[model samples]
Target: MSESSESTIESGGIGLSEDALRTLKLVADDEPIPDDDPGLRDLRALHAVVPNTHRPGHWILLDPQQTAHNLLWRGIEEVTGILDRLTHVPKITEALTVEHERGRWRDGVGSEYIEHADQINARLDQIMASATEELLTAQPRKRSKSLLTMALPRDSALLERGCKMRTLYPYSARVGVHEPKWMREMAKRGAAVRTLSIPFPRMIIVDRRHAFIEDLVFDSSPPHSGWYVTDRPVVEWMSMIFDLYWTRADPWSEPLDQAGRLTNPIQRSILRELVAGLDQKQIANRLQISEKTLSNHLTDLRTKLRFKTTYQVVHWWATAAENSSALELRDGEPFPNFPGTEGP
Candidate 1:
């Protein structure tokens, strides 16, 4: 690798430099492709390390995995989640190491208590760079675009390394302008980005061996200012918490992207809330859309369902819930079918 390639993170054959390539291995593109590079090229085939179009010196892989990684670092990360989506990985975590292990700390718990943001950031970068197998993360708050952008390189390295990773976010994250778009982009690169309706602490677990937990109770707390735990039990437990949420999370495969038309989750949310017997105002408040917006959504949904009144929509929803547990609602369908519900 040249100094230019070294300037950014190394994909390490795992494209640990490119999120999509993290699942792959790579070699730098040169004046001409080399045979040894060809041997390495098998892994790099799926990814391209884009040279800086405007700046000749700088180069990067257009990491697809960084989409989820983007927000995980937002609001101080919810890492692969808050993975810093600490959207934890279930396959790797399910098998916890049998023995209790410790780290280089004085307590030998291998844990570090970091109160400063800069120290936390530096340590996280160091640990993530060292991760060999997987990255699990969570991001509790809606992330800003700038934070997501800054995180691309770090998160992309994990993907490029082919390290397994997943990210967790609030279901509400879908409503954000950036979150939904980010989730869609990242999910394509083998980053498992899921959103939960419930609450979770901001965390990032790397390889299920090391974990970062922010000061969850205090919003005023500094970024990356939290405890770093290496105790196997604690890390395992955090990973487990992530799994519980993962089980309930809505995987981010959208309908229009797949085969549907009613593309908004908020509309589906409204229908669900309506079935729960909440009025429009309540449904709007619960889903965090404005009543006017909610009213418009209701109107649009009604038009799609071809129902004349709110009662008919509710009736169809209730009937669908009762009849076919096998039926699933889709965005493309005129009326949505929930995971276990029937469609009208």
Candidate 2:
């Protein structure tokens, strides 16, 4: 072979035979292969075969039976045995080596380890012993008696430690007679309680530092699975959510007002609209009164309350009406004669 032909054969492997090499050179030189060329067919056939060379420096390949015996059963058993034996061996050997090298100081090092461990234990004990604060938790359904009973004491203890408590219950709990009574008792002890159609995730945050949340799937069992104790951003987030709900909640102190006697139907209607957070236009629409009449009533309210702006009028009305019973007129009773009765 010529020097160039030998070089081509070495570089291109099986496809570098004289005729095939010539065809490939023509293709490389931008000449398309002609349909009638036998060299082109040979080159194409060689190119179609896949090269299965192993990666560099790794030529290990076992037969199927050998692979199964080595990798599946024997290899795993061997690896596990080695790991088990070596689990403590490395540390033990390292310690022995260190002791041999520094005999007298080894005792000091061991004492240092004990001292650090004691410090860690003391810190953890302090955290555990610190009186926990009030906590509010929500569960989707009634938990086991034992679980709830345990929680109740913790809750009471927290409350006794000057922590304010609140709890949310699913609406289903409201249907249970016992549940409401239990909630009422909790309320009497200064804990706020509310019921929602569906109470969200079961969560408890203690003193805004520690939180326990459900991490497992909801299951009804003793080891009522799905409990996770965390002390991080989760606690902060849950505390904020609890405070938001607490602010909007109607406290048990505000008993339902049953007194309904209307001195002025129009004024009471306007007051209701104001408390409902409606704009003047909306109030007029609902009351079937014109915008001008609504404005006139608002002006009268402002003047009567000695207020300067419309906002002041609203604030005065809301403050005055918040605790008052809703206005009502007895059957066949005449509308209470007020100064503004002349208007439509």
Candidate 3:
């Protein structure tokens, strides 16, 4: 080869350094190269130059083309083997996953405790992505607008796949600027969203086969972890709980009006919580509203009903519970009209 071509090979066109190319050339021409020559190291490493058994201290150069061909052939074989293994990876993984899932099923231990919020979100994405039949969620706490915005694309994708999605939120969520609009947008996309006046636990059920719920410690104290559950009985029970709440919740699109009642949904929820013997702070927490907001709602209720004090409000609530037949009566639907309870 010409010097330039030899230089190219030396510079890694073929991984043969310039000195190694020189050693090769000398060997090819039947010229003896010194054992300690600088170029001999590269030639020896490549195995292109070998010891001459008949003449000690002498080296032989194999045909370069054949040597190149051999290297190329070996490389091709190695890469083909890697490709073949890569092709089978999915099958092997799938088989192992099947066995793993079955073992968990048989052992009645199909739950994973995830501690971090980010990890929980990631697992939720995976669960939702795999959902083909239905998605159900109950959120007892209010969500930030940013969180709702982040979930829009994923929820939209689920709806687009023709999967049924149902979500339940506290009635206090309707007081937000973003939540009602987000709920309506999702409802328009064929998702069923409802607001409940009563308290419920946070849950996410996919296909009625898998679920995620809050994790509690051995002492029944919350550790801020999540349990990803696939246990059949547990998941089924959770699904039923969701269905029970869902049936009683008011649809997102409908205004909370029951025959032109005076109290709205939030006020009714506050009244119910008060009737349940919850203090202002506890009522606010359960209804997913601030204490000030809860107090404001109570003040509005008092003004509307022409009551003078909180005691009178609760007293009337108790009396109405017994005598008001046309009223909400259950699950905190908007209160129906009483004979003299009309307000502007």
Question: Top lDDT: which candidate number?
Answer: 3
Residues 170-266, candidate 2, lDDT per residue (tens digit)?
4445545456666766777677776533125566555677555543422222243233334456566677666544433333344322344211344
Cα-based TM-score, every candidate: 0.47, 0.34, 0.60
Worst 10 residues of 2 by lDDT: 109-118
Q: How accurate is candidate 2 locally (lDDT)?
A: 0.52
Ranking by TM-score: 3, 1, 2
lDDT of each: 0.61, 0.52, 0.77
Off by more than 4 A, model 2 = 1-129, 144-146, 216-223, 227-231, 245-344
Clashes of each: 56, 0, 0
lDDT of each residue in 1-344, candidate 3, tens digit only: 44644564445445776677677778777776778776776776565788787877678888879788877886688789999999999989877776665455435567876656778889889988988999998988878788899889999999999999999988887877788888888988999888887788999999999898886632322355677899898898788777767766778778787665667767777877787788999988877888998888889878988988998988887766423433433455544344466897
Pairs that clash in candidate 2: none
Candidates 2 and 3 compared: the better one by TM-score is: 3
Candidate 3 pairs with clashing backbones: none
